[model samples]
Target: GSWHPETGGLHEAFGDITAILTMISQMDQCEAIICHSKGDLHAKTYFSAVAEEFGYALYGRTQGLRNADNDLTMSQVTEEVHDISQVFTGAFYDILADIFEDYCCPEKYDAAETLFRIGKHITSLLLQALLKGPSSNATFSDIAKLMISLEPKKKWKDMIRRQFSVRGVVGKGAKKVKAPVDLVWGGCHCS
Candidate 1:
């Protein structure tokens, strides 16, 4: 559901708006429709129609929910923005690597691939966090620390361990830590 204003033409935006409306039309039991970016006239119109048709409460500025536009409730926006930043950082790294390889060693794409993978993984983690809304009782930072620890790089493992230590937590849980390697392995250890 990533929309780039530069890449998405007017027709594509219209199609997305139409598709959203079509999905809303099929919902049997919709309580509250929370539409972000209701500042867009097209989205506002589509959401208004959805609210009316489904008799669902609309909670967006388009319908007059001004107080809900505060920065606290829209944490997903910040997370998504971070995801986009990570994506761009990876893309920039790839582009630079491509240019370097064209003039230097042609087999250095692996480095770029690794960079891209890290960026993609970070973005995916943030997306999962967004899907599992923060109020559902899991912080994205904690999930990120866990995922980073699972990487093949020792740096990520040490980073997570250091973060856990700084937070004054004994182990992955609140109990005493038995072994650092055990917590870092997360059931994948052998031999």
Candidate 2:
């Protein structure tokens, strides 16, 4: 489906997200290094046990993130799914961050344990959102809207919307999809 822009990107994104969720499901939940170190703090994020490479576009020399934090608006995007996919991926990351921050270590909410639980919960939410949220030819905003509707508790609603908003994915004043669109040749188109 990479052959087409209207639908291919979402399918590719669905596969990528599903794969990440599946991997996390199989992984043994470890106490975040922060929790294990007593008080040695680290940047709050999904700490991959191995070198992770989901967002190839997100990687950089110093910090590796292809706007998965959802800082890039749709108006700023091109036609490439990998680049565009970061908007959703960033939302997912921020959701994880929100959960991590909200459930900070308490007597009841241990930091390490909360990290484990967040993985499980987010995996389910991501699956549900992928299956039930986005439409076939969905724009980023459409997926965002569908996801917002399916949230039973409005969990991270404001954050998700705000992320999508500035990126031009959705909100009161989203503009049109413009181009010189970016494209990935992926062998088929290379010849």
Candidate 3:
């Protein structure tokens, strides 16, 4: 399920955290498979097959684990899970604050909903990048281009393009200027 802050109380929040951890574990497994196989088509095909067969099995195990925690009572949550949840929440809040600062029309959006959509979009971009190639050295620009290409909305595409533009400080004769260092896209760099 998508991230919705208004959904429930602490119990639901714990469940969502548990689910996110499970998904991360699954992605780690897939990444290992890809790396071990040197990112061949056979590896991708095998992952597809494995995902279809064991996806529900993993989900069941996650649910059972959650259920065993007795609805994620604070006292029942393991120390590790508790720590992870804290870190995740802190990071979410930090990112949300950054987005709010950067957003042009914050008044037009709900903070929680915007954060949720950002989370979903980032997840989608990550998975799409993995599917494109299991390159260990994939850069931010690579993912940004993928996002720009996959995003259907022109406004979002423009926003992404602007976001990815290079910015740096230039100095000459004791003068300093903050400026767009370059606008790099599709292997072309412009300043």
Candidate 4:
């Protein structure tokens, strides 16, 4: 209902993450689980074939409108929901990357299973945060603070803080993205 950078972005992130998670759920194997996103035309393959294409709005059917791997900051945000969403989404994506780094390597300790396990945990935390992470007029910092406050004191706790912190999503030190719409309309729109 309103136009707020912070809420809009967070809403976008929720859509992207949920779509990716759904794609992963349907696939039996997640070989490139850490880095695989083709953004292909095929409903089943786009999630795995196109890597790094996080919903590019240009070139329509060719790429995604956003990229979670993008290194965006407050200054880079364009006040667009998708653009702003990338910042927080990037942090979540990085957490997955970090988990991949930790569990998927020469160590080879059932990397696939570890990836899924960690992926589930990350999704759980994300959902928890979304459900009760922030309050009215929440900003990027609010997300981090809320999640940090609600998050259990476990190994990933610090990592969670660092991920958001690195992306300038945590604490009052970072720039604030404001506003929040009650309804957020986002979809593949993949021509």
By TM-score, who's the top model here? 4
Better of 2 and 3 by TM-score: 2
RMSD of each: 18.9, 5.6, 20.4, 7.4
lDDT of 4 by residue, 151-182 (tens): 57555667677888767777545765444556
Candidates sorted by TM-score, best first = 4, 2, 3, 1
Model 2 residue 129 CA deviation in Å = 2.4
lDDT of 3 by residue, 1-191 (tens): 12211112223333543344343245455355335535331222332222233445666432232221111222222334333233222222232233423442547754333434454654564457446732433323344456567766676555554443321001121112122233345664768
Supply candidate 1's per-residue lDDT for 53: 27
Local distance difference test scores for all models: 0.31, 0.55, 0.36, 0.61
Model 1 spans with C-alpha error above 4 angstroms: 1-113, 129-158, 163-191
Candidate 2 lDDT over 1-191, as tens digits, reads 22335245566556555544554454343443444434222343444211235344445323333333445555565677766666566555556667666656778866666666666877766567667754445555566776666656665666666655666667776656443235566665553
Models 1 onward score TM values of 0.23, 0.65, 0.30, 0.70
Q: Against the correct fold, how does model 4 do in TM-score? A: 0.70
Candidate 4 lDDT score at position 113: 54
The lDDT, on a scale of 0 to 1, for candidate 1 is 0.31
Clashing pairs in 1: none
Stretch of 10 with least lDDT, candidate 3: 166-175
**Model 1 — which ten-residue stretch has the worst lDDT?**
66-75
Q: Which candidate is the best by lDDT?
A: 4
